[model samples]
Target: MSLLFAPFKLREVTFRNRIVVSPMCQYSSVEGMATDWHLVHLGSRAVGGAGLVITEAAAVSPEGRISAADLGIWNEAQAERLRPITDFIKAQGAVAGIQLAHAGRKAATEAPWRGGQPLGPERGWLTLAPSAIAFAPGYECPREMTEADLDQVSVQFAEAAARACRAGFEVVEIHMAHGYLLHQFLSPLANHRRDGWGGDLEHRLRFPLRVARAVRAAFPSHLPVFVRISATDWVEGGWDLPQSIRLARALEAEGCDLIVASSGGAVPDARIPAGPGFQTPFASAMRQEAGIKTGALGLITDPAQAEQILATGLADMVVMARELLRDPYWPLRAARALGADVQWPVQYQRAKLG
Candidate 1:
């Protein structure tokens, strides 16, 4: 039997297979509301046979958005719009998940296709971070977060998690990766504060961990809370494997169910050795050292490669992004390649391979 097709459970949720759709921003929302585009974009992956389909990082607050068009669940109206999309995913026998995020200093930028530059004052709001730092030279300098701001952001994340549950999602992955708000605090490269929230590793972890605890508490107890973390900043003396392992352990202690191990993005210029399965080692190390379930992402395209990652105990699940975009039915194709018997949608039964 292929491990890739095996069911994996966390809390009361059971994924039909090991394949997960990594959250990729759609940059297709209006005033933080989900549209039909999100429904068709996310629902198709569930129909294509993924075990879990995670929506793109949904900003917990309006100002947390990466771009003007980024998805949001900051209010009840936005959460209601997500209900239909999650329902469709679950109907297709896939677990629905959402990634809660805050872009911090990276907020208020144009979409990637539109040059991805920072927006001017007319179109942008002040960004917030551990310190008043810019992600890159061209990016806007963020305001140093006051204690009140920290408290408010934590409440926002908790409320967002509660709303995601009401919207029918079974999993909530906190987006602490990709140089966003939580990640900004995690990496010394972006956080330069001398206060209790940023001087050392433990201090740097304070706010992110507080947010994780709040989110885990707000989400349903029977559901799983996953945190996506940049295992390393990929910059010297920045956030690295040791720090990530410690963070994973801390998250686990706070009731987080899994760590989705990804790397870099804290800084724009850090050198990352990008290739197939390049990040599995970080997941492997975290699982071994931190003693928590982990999902390996980053360039995980092939079925054999994904299977091997789990088969050898490198990670618990394989999270795919670009490859899944290229073929939403990659899981079905992988089932055939691994000789695992998987069910196809009734409408597509005739196309099922032997």
Candidate 2:
């Protein structure tokens, strides 16, 4: 049997296959509540046969949102709204997952369709980070976080994890990638502080590790916790693969089940050799050096390519973003392409040609 269609067990949970629905922000929510649109968008992917379906980056607090429209789990009402979505995903035989995130300096931006610019006081709110810095020229500069603020953010992550468990999510992925809050703390380029939360690699990683440990304490041991990290900043003197390996090892010791390896978030101008499976090397290296399981993301589009990734032990799982968006049934098609027998939704079975 192809590894792609084989069962993948992490902690007490087992995925039916290696295909995971990567979290892609929809930028469509009201006060952080998952709407009907979220249901259909995520549910259809589950019905289409993904083994694991992860929700987009969900803010741990309202202020942590990347955009005003980002989904959140800061309150019970938001949790309640997500319950049905999780139930629907499980009903379709997929494990429901959520990516817990805090955008930090990147928060309070308009949706991509609405110019993807920072929000001002009249529209955007103040952003927070390890240090006061804008991601790039013309971007809004964020305020440096105080020790009290750091403590509060950790508590918020713990609370969000508890809420996600209550909402019936099986896997909780901490979004430390994509130049978000955690990334802000991890990247030396963005984090310029004199305190315990910044300076050397150990200090720079302190905040994110603290948040992970707190979140682990909040969730049950059986529930798997995944931490997504930008393996490289793609810039000189920034977060890179060696540091990623160290962090992955530390995260594993702190109960992380997997490291979702990605790259290039701290510096937008840094050149990334983008192509199909551009960042798989990061996952491959982390897995080999740190002895931790990893999920590979970025531009992975074909079934054969995905299987090759798994076959070579490069990554434990293949996470596709745009490919899955283009074809929600990509996994079902992938199984067929790999000559594996995977069930199709009964309603769509009639449409399946021999």
Candidate 3:
């Protein structure tokens, strides 16, 4: 039997397989509302046989959006629009998941296809962060946020979690990775505060842990909550594996069900040794050391490679992004490639070999 195709359970949710449709930003929303593009984009992956289909970074607040067109769950209207998309995904026998995020200094930037440049005041507003810092050259220097700001933002995340649960989502993954808002606070490279919210590892972890606790309290206990974190900043003196293990343990204490292990995005200058499954080790390490389930990500492609990951217990689940975009039916195809039986949608079952 293929471990990759085996069912996995967390909280009250049982995934049909260990394959997950990693959230990929579409940059196609209008004013934070998911349009028809989202329904089709997300629905296709569910129909394609992914066990869980997670949405792109859905900002918890308007200011948390990475781009003006990012998906949001802050308001009822925005959450309401996601109903049909989630319904379709569930109809395909896939769990509907959403990643709640805050971009911080990364906010107010154009989409990648638009060169990912910092937006002008005419298009984007001011941004906030733990400290006044810019992500890179050409990005705006964010304003240092106050304690009040932190408290309010934490509440925003909780409210977003509640909204996501109401939007027909069964899973909520907190986006704390990729040099976004939470990671900025975790990495000393971005957070240079000399206060309780930053400095040493304990201080730095304060806000993130607080947000996780609040989100857990707001979300239903029957469902699982996952935190996507950069297992390493991929830079010297930045967030590394040891720190990540500690953070993962702390998150687990805060009721996190799993950690989606990814790396880098703490800075643009870090040398990332990108290769096939370069990050799988991080997931394995986190799972063993932190004693928490982990979802392996980053450059992991191919059916055999995925099966090996699960077979060896390198990760509890594997999230795929670029590959899924290239082939929405990848999970179904992967089952065929592995000689494992997986159910295809009724309309498409005729194409599967008897």
Candidate 4:
């Protein structure tokens, strides 16, 4: 039997297979509200037979959005809009999950279609971060977050978690990866504050840990919580795999159910050796050293590659982004390619080639 088809349980949530639809931003929301585009986008993956389907990084507050169009759960109204989406995903026998995030200095950017530049008053916004620094030379400089700002952001995370539960989401993954807010704090390259949130490793990790703890506390014990981290900043004098392993262990102790191991994203100048499964080694290392469950992501495209990652125990789960976007039915196709028994939706049964 293929291990990729094997069911895995984290806390009380059980995934029917190892295939997970990694969070891919749609940039299709309106004022942070999920629209029909989100429902169709996510629900199709569930119908395609993925064991887990995670929505894109959802902002915890308005200023936390990566772009003006990113989905959010900052308010009860937004949660209500998400209710049908989660219900649809679960009805298709897939676990519905969400990645809670704050973009920090990366916030208030134009949509990917609109050049992805920083948003100004004309476009409607201001950016905030652990420190006042721009991601790149031409990027907009963000305002430094005060201690009060930090406290408010933490509360925002907790509130988001509560809303997630009410929205019928079974799992919540904290987005600490991809050079966002939490990641900015983790990287010394971005965070240069002398305060408790920026000086050393312990200090840098404090804000993220506090947010995780608060979110975990807000949700019930049975609900699983995961944290996605950029395992390596891919730059000298920046966060690396070893530090990621240590951070993973600490997060586990603080009640994180899994570490979604990804790499790069602290400095735009850092060169990442991009290729198929380029970052799996980081995930492998974290699992071995941190003694915690982890999800390996990054260029994980083929069925054999995903199976190999799980079969060898390099990681507990596999998350694919671009691949899934290319083919929403990738999971179903993978089950067939790997010779695993997975049912097709009744309507599409006649269309199954095999």
Whole-model Cα lDDT of every candidate shown, in order: 0.95, 0.92, 0.94, 0.91
Better of 3 and 4 by lDDT: 3
RMSD of each: 0.8, 1.0, 0.9, 1.2
Task: Please report the candidate that would top lDDT against the real structure.
Answer: 1
lDDT at position 271, candidate 1: 96
lDDT of each residue in 93-154, candidate 2, tens digit only:
89999999999988888899999887876778888999998877656788899878988999
Local accuracy of candidate 3 as per-residue lDDT tens digits, 229-270 = 998988889999999999999998899999999989989999
lDDT of 1 by residue, 1-354 (tens): 999999999999999999999999999999999999999989999999999999999999999999999999999999999999999999999999999999999999999999999996789989999989888988878999999999999999999999999999999999999899999998999899998999889999999999999999999999999999999988999999999999999999999999999998998998999999899999999999989999999998888998999999999999999999999999999999999999999989989843
Look at candidate 2 and give me any clashing residue pairs: 119-124
Candidate 4 Cα misplacement greater than 4 A, ranges? none
Against the true structure, candidate 4 reaches a TM-score of: 0.97
Q: Lowest summed-lDDT stretch of 10 residues in model 3?
A: 345-354
Worst 10 residues of 1 by lDDT: 345-354
Report the candidate with higher lDDT, 2 versus 3.
3
> For residue 71, what is the lDDT in candidate 2?
98
| Residue 207, candidate 2: alpha-carbon lDDT | 91
lDDT of 4 by residue, 243-328 (tens): 88879989999999988888777887889899998888888998999899988899999999999999999999998889888999
